[model samples]
Target: MNKSELISVCISDNRVCPMPPQWVKFEELLSEMGNGKPPQSLILGYWFDTSDEEKRKCVQQQIDWAYERGLLDFAIEYLTQLKPNQWHTGYRK
Candidate 1:
């Protein structure tokens, strides 16, 4: 899909935060990187869908840091989901 369509899907599905103007720019940037195909899961939940362990760790550390600084209202649900490896998949079949 095009960038606008992708943004509409993301917003409709609650993938990315919809209220912030920066999110539109972020989607634009991601679409550019993806050659117009936005990474759905990453845009949905960066901490949830990333496959790189280092990136996940970095994001978690940042969340922790933000919480410590009172910059975030961190939630346990963020850590409750199974690892990406455990997610069920049959879409490719």
Candidate 2:
């Protein structure tokens, strides 16, 4: 999908562009880096980062969003449509 289509999908399905909340946070982080909210500056000596937490939250949000959008079964059905040949146990003498 092109940018426009993807934007529409996210907005309609996820309620936000890109749908992943962390991506939105990440964008904010970048926007703040210049203003002094940089991760490295915050952690200093720690490895803990909000990015990981944000990512997990975003994944959860995506799951919830997809479920709410009723796309889970649709996606499964779509994939099912692509199912390859099924095999049954059979042998010829």
Candidate 3:
């Protein structure tokens, strides 16, 4: 699907944050990288006011999860760029 369609799916499925105003750009970025394909593995979560160690652990978990799902490129290129306050993982099958 196209970027707009992907974004719509993400919203409809509650795969990403429900904050449309904020996440529209993020979904667009994912759609661009996906090149019209949907991700096989998508993880979305949030953390707040955590210790550095905890943040590291969360990040590592995201990486490990994406890698095991064969989404290392997406993990490195997109997931790693996310802010610590939120988590997003996506990988093409």
Candidate 4:
């Protein structure tokens, strides 16, 4: 799937985000990176912030979606390179 299509799927899927507007720009940026480019640090940081169980599960779905579309390796590489942190909901505890 192309970037635009992927972004649409992500935005429409509640499993991806309850508030899709909050993720539109981020998804757009990710789309712009294209399939060949490595995921950027900003994307890594964003994924690292999925500290809540629900959000983590949503992200896991996203990873699976990307994997099905041949984007998993990039996602995995980006995620693996980031340091873990407590960033659940609006709290950074």
Candidate 5:
């Protein structure tokens, strides 16, 4: 899917968050994230389905960094392997 589609999926997946995260072109949005700023989890969360190609690519590059730091990337990578409907019904063939 394209960047916008990807972003939509990611946000929909994380609908539980009260302030569903969004990508920013401004420093102010980064500030709201926190002092250390845009923590890896938040950054990765904004990565998957962002509408901006540059931002998505940048975030993709940091997936390993986020994973190494024990943030959101770890779980997302694990769950990503479980493709849609592959787990359900037990066997496809």
Candidate 6:
């Protein structure tokens, strides 16, 4: 995939905050990164610098977001088929 098409990552703010109380913190981080508005397309970025747990948090957040909108069917199949580590990067291994 084209790098420009991917959401720009901020390795310094690599933690993916969980929903509920921490959702505000996550939004603040996004606003600081200049993505205050809802992205036109799916927003995804990954970095090798972050921990494997953080990568899982990021993917979980996306799944939660889609499920909230009743769009889980759109993502469930592809996501479920991947091995746990495969979700940690933007590229296929």
Q: After superposition, how far is residue 90 of candidate 5 from its true place, in Å?
A: 34
lDDT, residue 80, candidate 5: 44
lDDT digits (tens) for residues 1-93 of candidate 3? 333333343333223332222234434544455454332222234333433344334344434444455555664455334454443323222
Q: TM per model?
A: 0.27, 0.27, 0.35, 0.40, 0.26, 0.39
Q: What does candidate 5 score on TM?
A: 0.26
Candidate 2 off by > 4 Å: 1-49, 74-93
lDDT of each: 0.34, 0.33, 0.39, 0.43, 0.35, 0.37
Worst 10 residues of 5 by lDDT: 14-23
In Å, residue 19's CA in model 6 sits off its true spot by 23
**Residue 82 in model 1: lDDT:** 25
Per-residue lDDT of 1-91 in model 5, one digit per residue for the tens? 3334433433343221112232232123333432334433324456445444444344443333344444444335332443444211111
Poorly placed runs, candidate 5 (over 4 Å) = 1-21, 24-51, 72-93
Tens-place lDDT digits, model 2, residues 25-64: 4335443433333222112222134343343344334334
Clashing pairs in 4: none
* lDDT digits (tens) for residues 3-38 of candidate 6: 211222311133232322233334343434432432
The sequence of per-residue lDDT tens digits that candidate 4 reaches over residues 1-93 is 544444344333223332333334334534555443322222345656644455545555555555665765565454333333312233333
Better of 1 and 5 by lDDT: 5
Q: Report the number of backbone clashes for model 4.
A: 0
Question: Candidates ranked by lDDT, best first?
Answer: 4, 3, 6, 5, 1, 2
For residue 86, model 4's alpha carbon misses the true position, in angstroms, by 7.9
lDDT of 5 at 39: 33
Worst 10 residues of 4 by lDDT: 81-90
